[model samples]
Target: CFYLLFNSVLFSVLSDVELRSYRWLQTMIFTVEEINRNPVLLPNLTLGYLATDTCLSEGSTLSAALSIVTGQDKAVTEQCTKAPNVSLFPFFFCAPHLQVSYFASCACLSDRTRYPTFLRTVPSDAFQAQAMARLLRQMGWSWVGVIYGDDAYGKSGVQLLIQELEGSGVCVDYTEVIPKSHALEKIKRIVERIQSSKAQVVVTFAISPDIEVLLKEVVRQNATDRQWIATEAWSTSTHYSAWSGISLVGTLGFALRRVDIQGLGSYLTQLSPEEHTNEQLVQNVWEEVFGCKFGKEMYSGPHCTGLEKVEVQGEAYFDVMYNVYKAVYAIANAIQDIFFFLPTYIKYGQSKKLISGVKFTTPVGELVHFDNNGDPSASYDIINWHMGAEGKVEFVKVGQFDAARGPQQDFQLDLINMENRLYIIQVPVSVCSESCPPGTRKAVQKGKPVCCYDCIPCATGEISNANSRECTKCLERFWSNTDRTECIPMLVEFLSFQDIMGIILSVLSIAGATLTGTVLTAFFYHRDTPLVRGNNSELSFLLLLSLKLCFLCALAFIGRPAPWSCMLRHSLFGISFVVCLACVLSKTVVVLVAFRETLPGSNIMRYFGPAQQRAGIFVCTLVQVLICVLWLVLAPPLPTESAGGELGARVVLLCAVGSVIGFSLVLGYIGLLAAICFLLAFFARKLPDNFNEAKFITFSMLIFCAVWIAFVPAYVSSPGKYTVAVEVFAILASSYGLLLCIFAPKCYIILLKPEKNTKKSMMAK
Candidate 1:
C-alpha cells in the first residue's frame, strides 16, 4: 500500500472549522480513489491516505511531519512501498519525506536546498508579488497602504512585493502587520492607521483568518472608502466574504487560475456517514455542512438524515479543490514514472527526484509540470468584487496575469468589462497627488516618495507637456507659448513701417526733408539777393542739399534693416553732416577775414575768396567721404537678429556694427569738425551786422554737437527697435537744427523782411 499523509486545519481546534478546508480534504481522498481505479497508469498499485488534523497549529504540523520522516506512526507499515505526504497547510518545518503542498505559496519554500523534498501545485509568492506589482502600476495606483499578517507567509510575501515595487513608482504610505493572535487592540490600531492614511488603495497580504479578524475591526470603525487589493491567500475565500458586507465591494484581487474536475461534484454529493462510518472527518463535515450531528452527539444539533446532499457552495470554494486534485495526481504520476521508465524501486528520498522531473498532461487537458524550484507555472485570474444581481458580493473575472508571457505582455485586462464595469467607470483615484497637466512639471516633495509631489509651472523660456517631470528649453529662434505647452516661432521685431513708432519717425523724416526742400526753393528764388550772396550762395546751396540727404537718410533707419539699408543709412548720415558742417566753417572764416580786411588793409579778403571757400568746403567733405568708403569696405554693418527683451520672446532684427572702431571713427570725425566750426563761428559772431551768418552757424554747430553727444549714450542704452528710433531721432534733430538756425533767418529776411536783405543792410554794423 502507498501511504499519502494529508495534513490540514481540521477538527476546529485553533479556529472555527472551515468548510473549504473540509472540501480540500475530500478532494485529496477523491483523487486517490480515482488514481487507484486507473489501470494503465498504476496497474497493481492501490493508494491509501492518512489524514491528520493540524488544527492550524505549528506544533501539530511539525509533529505530523516528524512522524512521516521517522516512520514512527503505527499506520506506516513495512509493506508500504512509498509514503508521499501531501499538506494542505503551510509547512515551516523541513523533512526527508516527499511533501507536496496544495497551496503553500510562500516564496521561501522554493529554496530547494532547505525544502528539497517539497513540491507544490501552487506557484510561489514571488510570482504573485510580481503580478501584484504589475497590476498596481498598470492601474496607476502609485500611493497605497499595506497591511500584512505577522507570519512567515505574510512577511515573506510583503518583502517580495516591496522588492518588486522598487523603481516602479509605486509607494507604500504605511505598512501595518496584523497579529496572528487576533488581538482586538492590535487589529483596531491597524484599522486606525488605514482610516488615517490619505492613501485610498490598501493592499492586504494575509490569510483568510487574519484578514477576517482585521475586516471585523475595519467594519466596527466603518472605514470602507478604500479600494482593497487582495492577494491570492484570501482573495476568493468565502470565510471573509460572508461577513465582509459592502466593504468588500469594488475590491480587486488576484486568484489562482480555476479549473473544473469531472465528476467531482457528483462524488461530493454522494458522501454519507454510512459509507464512511469509521471516518470521523466525514462525520464532522456532514454535521458541519448540514448543521446536524450523528450518533447522539454531545452538541445540541439535529441528527443527520443521511439524505442531505452536498452542493458546491461557491466558485472559489470549489476552485481550490483542483490544487488538491493535482497534488495527488502529481505524486501518482511520479510513482508511475519511477516504476515504468526508471525500472527501479522507489527509495525513501528518491521519490522527490522523480516527482521533480515528472511532466504530464491531466485528464482535463491541463499541463502539469514544475520548474527547478519545484513550483508550477504562475498564472492568475484577476477578480473584481462587485455587488451582484442578488445584492451580494460577486467575484467577477476581469483580467488575467500569465508569467509564461514576457513581463511586457504578461498582464492584460478584459477590455469589454473594464470599459463597462460600474466600479471601474469612475476608476478610484488612489494617488498621493494628481498628475501634472501640460505646461507644468512635477516637483517632488522633500523627504517624501515620488508619488507625493507638487505641480510647478514651466519657466518663461521653457516648456513642459502633460505628465512631464522636467521643463524643456525652447530653441534660440523659438519661444514658448503663453501656456508653456509648446514652442512657437519668435516674433521678429524691428523699426518696421507698420509699427506706430516707425510711422511717426518716418513722417518726421519726410516732413524734415520737405521743409529742407522748401528752404532750398526759397534760397534759389532769392539767389541774387544780398542776404543769399552775403552767405555765399554756392556753399549755402550745397549745405541745403546735404541737409535734405540727412533728413531722408533717417527713413533708412526707420524700416526693417537689410544689408543695403544698413550700410547706406550710416554712410549717408555721416557724409551729409560733414558737408553741412564744412559749409558753416567756411562761411565763418570768410566773415571773420572780411571784417578784419575792413579794419585795415588786411588782404585776407583776397585770400579768402569764393574759390578758396569752395575749395575748403570740398576738402573737408571729401575727408568724410573717404572715411565712409573705408568703413564700408573693411567691416560693413550687416542686418542681424538678437534675442532680448521680455522673456526673450522677440527676435530683434537690427543692423550689427561689424567694427566698433570704424563706427566710432565716423562719429568722432564728425564731432571734431563740429567743434572746430562752433569755436571759429563763436569768434566771428560779433564782427558785423543785423543777421550775422557766423552767429547762426555757431548756434547750429552747438545744437549739432549736443545732439550727437546725446545720441552716443541713447544708442548704446536703447533696446530692440527703440535703438533705431533713437538714432533716427538724433539725425532728424541735428538736421532740423542746421536747417532752421542757418537758413531760417536767411529765408525770413529774404521773404518777410526784404528791406533787410540789402547789401547796404548786410554791410551795416
Candidate 2:
C-alpha cells in the first residue's frame, strides 16, 4: 500500500519521549476517527496514514526533507506546487515553533525558487514582530536590548521585531546577535555584553537546545540578575527552569496553553461506522504488522498493568499526526474533485482551469482554497506552547485571525471579537484595561466580527446594564426621581415633638375660646333680664360677643389637620369672627354718636338712636359675609390623597387671600371701634358713675386688639409648638378683656357699694 512505505519512512523513531504528551496527538486522532466514520462526500474513497520521526535528533529528519525540497530547481519545484492561484504558500500545511535557526531555515527553503509546495500554518515572523512592537508601544518601553541567536531564525525574528518596534515608537538600545550553535559559551558572552550595555530588559530568541546551554552560562557569568523577557517559546522547559537567577520573567508573544478534550470522543462516535472502514482497515493492517491489538494498545498509549507489563499502542506513536494526515487527505480529495469534476462542472469543461472552488474540513476546523500572494483566504488559528509536567509541553489556542473581518486600528489583525475564543482563556489586552469603554461590552458574532456591545443608560429612576439596552428602576428607598444620571439622598418622614406641641397648644387655645364663648352666652341669655337696653351697656355686651367669636375661630385651626380642614374651618370661623367684630364696631359707633350728641350742640351727632346702632350692625355684618364669599370663590382646598396617599397632602392651607381678608377686616373694625371708645372715654373721663364704663371699655378693647394682633404672626409664621402657645395666650387675653369689660364694672357696683343697697332698701320701706 502507498501508506505502508509512508509509515516506514514516517515512523523512523518511536519512543516514550514523543509519546508522553498525547494532547495534540489525541486531538488529531479524534478528528481522523470522526472523518473516517463519516465519509459521505467520498463514499468509495478510503483514507490512509503515514507517520514521521521529525522530532528525532532535534528534528534532523525534518531538516533533511526540507533541504531536499529546497534543493530543487524552478521546473522541478513547480511540478510539486499545489496550485498557482492559491493565496497561501507552497506547503500544503506547516507548523513551526519559531526556533531561531529552524524558522529561518524553513522560511529560507520556502522561497518560490526553492520549494513552491511549502505552506506554513503558523503566522509569519513579520506578524510576531508586529505583535511584539504593539506590546512594547503599549507598555511605553522606550528602549530594549535585543539578544538573539545568530542563526536564520533569530536573525529573521530580530529583523521583524526591530522593524515593528521602530514603527510603534520604541527605540532599540543595542542588538547583540549570537551564534545559534555556540551553546552555553555564546550565552555568557551575550549576557556580559548586555550587562555592560545597561539595557533594562533583554529579549532572547533561541531554540530549546541552545536555551538551556545559554541559561547555565549566564548564571555562571553572574549576569542572571539582569531582567529578561521573551516570547511564549521561552516558556518551554529549556528556557523556563534553565534560567537560574533572573530577577524578572515576562513575555510579549502569544502566551496560552491546553485545549479542552471534554466530550470529544463521544461526539466523534456519532459519525457513521461504515465510513470509518478505511481507518479500521488501516488499524487492522498495523495490528498485524506490530503483532498486537490495533485500537487497544496501538490507538491509545501504553498503560502499566503490573511491574513488568506495559501496553504499547500504535496511536501513541502516530496519532498526534492526525491533523497533518487529515490536511493531506483533504488536499488529495480537493485535487481529485477539481480534476474529475471540473471537466463537467466548468463551462468549457477544462480540467486545467484554476481550481478556485476547492475546500475541505480538517482537524482544526475548515480549510478553504487560498487567493494569490500565498495569503490564506480562510481563517487561521494563533497558538502558543508552554512547559508542562515532566518536561512535556502544551499548546494554548489564543484567537483566530480572519481576513474577512476588518483589520486592527493599528493595521494589525483585529483581536476584538477573538477575545472570547477558547484559546484565549485569559482576557485579551486590547479590552481588559479599558473594558469596552463606557458604552460597550465584549460581544462576538458569526459571519461578521462582533465589536463590543453598547450599554444604554436608563431614564429617570432607572438603572442601566453594562452590556445591554435593558434598564431597571431604583427601589423606593433609593429614589432617583430624575433620570438615572445621579442618585440623591432619599427623603424620609419623621414627626417631631415640637410639631405635636404646636398642635396641642392650638387645641387648648380653641378649647379655652369655646369655654369663654359659653360663659359669655350664658351671661347674656341665661339671665331673665336684659344686660343692656341701649348703647350704654351695648358696647360691653358686643365686646364680649366679639371675643367669644374670636376664641371659637382660633379653636378651628388648633389641630392643623389636613389642608382641606384648615380651609373649611378657617372659612367658617372667619365668618363668625367677622360677625362678632361687626357687633363691636356697631357699639363703637353708638358710643361715638352718644358722646357727640351729648356735647353742648353738635347737630351732626344729634341723629343718635338705638335704630342707628342696629342699622350699623347689619351693614357691617353684610360686608363681612361678602368678604368671606370672595375668599371661598377665589381659593379652593385640595384633598389629602394627592401627596403620595398620605393624610397630609401638599396642599396650600396657607390662608392666602381669605386669611388676609379675615384678619384685616376683623382687626380694622376692632381698631376703629377702639378709637371711638377711646374718644368717648376721653370726653366722658369725668362723667357720672354709669358713664365711667366708657373708660374701662376703651382699655379692654385696646388690650384685646393688641394681644390678638400679636397672635396673628405667631399663628401664621411659627410652625408647631410656640405657635400654639401664642394662640392660646391671644385667645385668653381677648376672652378675659371681653369678660372684664362686660361684668367687671357691674360686679364692683353690685358687690362693693352697700350705701346704694341701703338706699334702695330705705326707698322700699
Candidate 3:
C-alpha cells in the first residue's frame, strides 16, 4: 500500500514554505514507516509513499497528478500496488470551486458525483473567508484595499471573501489584480497606487509567489508603515522572512491552529545510517535544516554523518506539518476500522465515511473532530509578524478566531504597544485623517469622508467642550473658560471692601472721620471763644457735624452692595449736604442782615433771631428727609448684576437706582440750595475784613456748585461700581472745600493770635 502527497508550490530561493511542506511530507513517511514496524497495526503489510511539488499552477498540479497516476518517479525497491488518491492540502480548497467555470458539466463539491474522491484534513477556504471578515470587524477596520492574484484560486477565494466582507460592516476602497506572469511595470503601478491612495490599511488574498512580488514592490516604494491584513493564503509562508529590509513589522494575519504529536521528537531523534542509508528524503531534509552535506564524499561544505539530531526541526513548523501527521493517522484509523468492523472492501468513497467524524486527542490535550460539511471547524490563530535578528521572523499568536465561539468572544486581541514617532503605547492608527479636539467643530472637505475635516472655533456666547461635535450656546448665568473648552460660573464683580480701590477708599474715609472728630474736639475746647462765636455758634456747630456725616457717607460706597447700603448711599449723601447747605444759607443771610442793622436802626435780628435761624436749618433738612422717604416708598434702590459692561467675563453686582426722577431730585435740591447761598454770599463779600466770613463762604459755595454740575454727567456715564465712585469723590471734594475754606481762617487766628479772640477787636471793623 502507498500514500501520495501533492503540494502546490516549491521554489529554491523562495522555498522556506515549500521546505516546510516537505517536512510535513517527511512526517507522513515517518508515520507509515512506524506503522510498518509496529506489530499491532498494519503488521502484515508495509505502506509506501511518493510526494511531489505542484508550483501553485494548474500545469504543475496536473503534471504532478499525472506523474502520481502513471507511477513514475518511484524508487525501484518500493512495492507495486495501486493506492487510493487523497489530498489534504489547504491551497487546493479553491481549485474545485473554480473548475465549474472551465467545465460546464462540473458542479462544486456539494454532491459526490462532481468529484467523488475529494477529501481534506484541513477545512475548506470558505471558513478562512469568514474568518478574514470577522477579524477585520473585530479590529474596527471598515475601509480597506483588496489585493489578489488573477488566477482561479485567487478569483474563487476573493469572491467568497467579498461575500463574507459585505455581510460584515466593511467596504473595500479598491480591488486590484496581480498579473499571472512576472510583470514588473504592472506591479510598480499597483504599488504606486497603494502609496497615493487614501487607504492606510490593505487586505491581501494571494499565494506566496504573488505576495512576495507585491511585498518586494512595497519595499521598493517604502510603504512599510502601512498596515497589512494578511489572509491564510500567504500568512504562514516564510519566503519573505529572510528579506530583513522588507519590513512587515505589524502585519496581522490568520494561521492554522498548532499541535504537537506525542513522542514525535523521540522518534525523530534516532535518525542514522545504522537504520536506513537509502532514504534520500531524510538526507535532503537533514542537509537543508542543519546546513550540512551528508556522507563521506569530498565536498566544499561540511557533511552530516547521519548522526545529526533532527529532534525539534519538525515541531518548529507544527502549524502546517501537524495537518499531514493527522491526515496519515486519519487514513490509518479509517482503514483499520473498516477492515475490522465490516467485510466491505476499502474503496476511496467508502473509506471516507469512517474518517469524516473520527475524534482523537492530540498530545497538547486538544480534541479534534470534523463537522458535517466534510471539513473541521474553524480554529485559526491571530498572529503578528515579529522581527528578529539576521532577517529571521517569529510568528506570535496574539489572538484567536473561532467560528463556533461567536464573533465577540472569538476575536480578542492582546493590547500591545504600537509605537510611533512621537508616542509610545499608542494604538495603531487607521484613518483618512485625524479627529478634531475640543473648542472646534468638524468642517468636512468637499470630496473627502466625514472623518477628514477642518476644525472651526465656536462663536461668541458658545463653547465646545471636550471633543464635542457641535457648539452650544452658554446660559446667561454661566461663562466659558479662556480656552473655550468648558463652562464655569460667572464672577460677581463690584467695588467691594476687599478690592484695592475699596480698601484705599475705606482707609481714607476712616481717616477723614477721625480728622473731623479732631476738629470737633478743637471747636468744643474753644466753644466760648470769640472766633467760635463769630457766627451763630449753634449754626457753626451744626455745619461741622454735617461735614462729619459727609465724610462717613463715603464708607457706604466702598462695600459689597445690599439693600440698606444702596438706599443709605444716596440718602445719606443728600440729607448731610442739605444740612450743611442750610447752615451756609442761614449764615449768609445773617451776615447781610446784621450788617444792615448796624448801619441804621434795623430790627431784623429780632424777627429772624437764633430761633429763626435754627428753624430755617430745620425746614431745609426736613424737605430733604421727606424726599428720601418718598423715594424709598416709590422706587427704592435694589442690588442687581450688570452684564455687557467694560469688564468682560465679570458680572458687576450693583445697587441699581430704580428711578431717574428720584436721583435727579436728590442732586437738584442740593444744587438749588448751593446756588442760593452762593448768590447771598457774593453780595456780602465787601463786608469788614476783620469780621467778615462772606468771602470765604462765597468761594466755597462756588466750588461746591462747580463740582456738582460736573458730577451729573460723570455719574450718568460711569459704569456699575464706577458710578458710585464718582458720587463719593464729588461729596468728599465739596465737603473738604467747605471744611477748609470756611474754617481754616478761624482756627489760624484763635490759635496764633489769641488777643484778637476778644470781642472788642472783632467789633472795630
Better of 2 and 3 by lDDT: 3
Minimum summed lDDT over a 10-residue window in model 2 is located at: 75-84
- Ranked by lDDT, top first: 1, 3, 2
lDDT of 2 by residue, 160-228 (tens): 787666445356667876553454456566777777753455666654334445655666666644445
The lDDT, on a scale of 0 to 1, for candidate 1 is 0.80
Cα RMSD for candidates in order = 4.8, 15.2, 10.7
lDDT of candidate 1 over 1-765, digit per residue (tens): 677787765533233557777778778888889989898767898887766666556556667667766777632111112211222355222222466788788888889888776788888999989989988988889999999877777889999999999999899999999875677888888898998888989998887667777887787788888888898877777666666777677788888888878988877777778888886667777776777878786767688877887776554445568888888888887767766755443544454566578687888899999988889999888988866666666788899999899877889987468546545324577889899999999999999998889999999889998878899999989999899999998988888889999889889999999999999999899899888886788888988998999999998887778899999998988888888888878878887777766556557678788898888988988988888888899999999999766778999999998889888888898899999989988988887568888898889988998999999899999988889899899999999999999988888888899988897887676
Q: Model 3: residues >4 Å from true position, as ranges?
A: 1-211, 221-233, 242-246, 254-382, 388-391, 399-504, 521-534, 558-567, 585-627, 630-698, 705-728, 753-765
Clashing pairs in 3: 8-55, 8-56, 293-303, 293-304
Identify the leading candidate in terms of lDDT: 1
Give each model a TM-score.
0.89, 0.45, 0.55
CA lDDT, candidate 3, residue 353: 55
Candidate 3 whole-model C-alpha lDDT, 0 to 1: 0.68
lDDT of 3 by residue, 514-610 (tens): 7677777777888998778876678888898998999899988877888999999989989999999999999999998877676465676887788
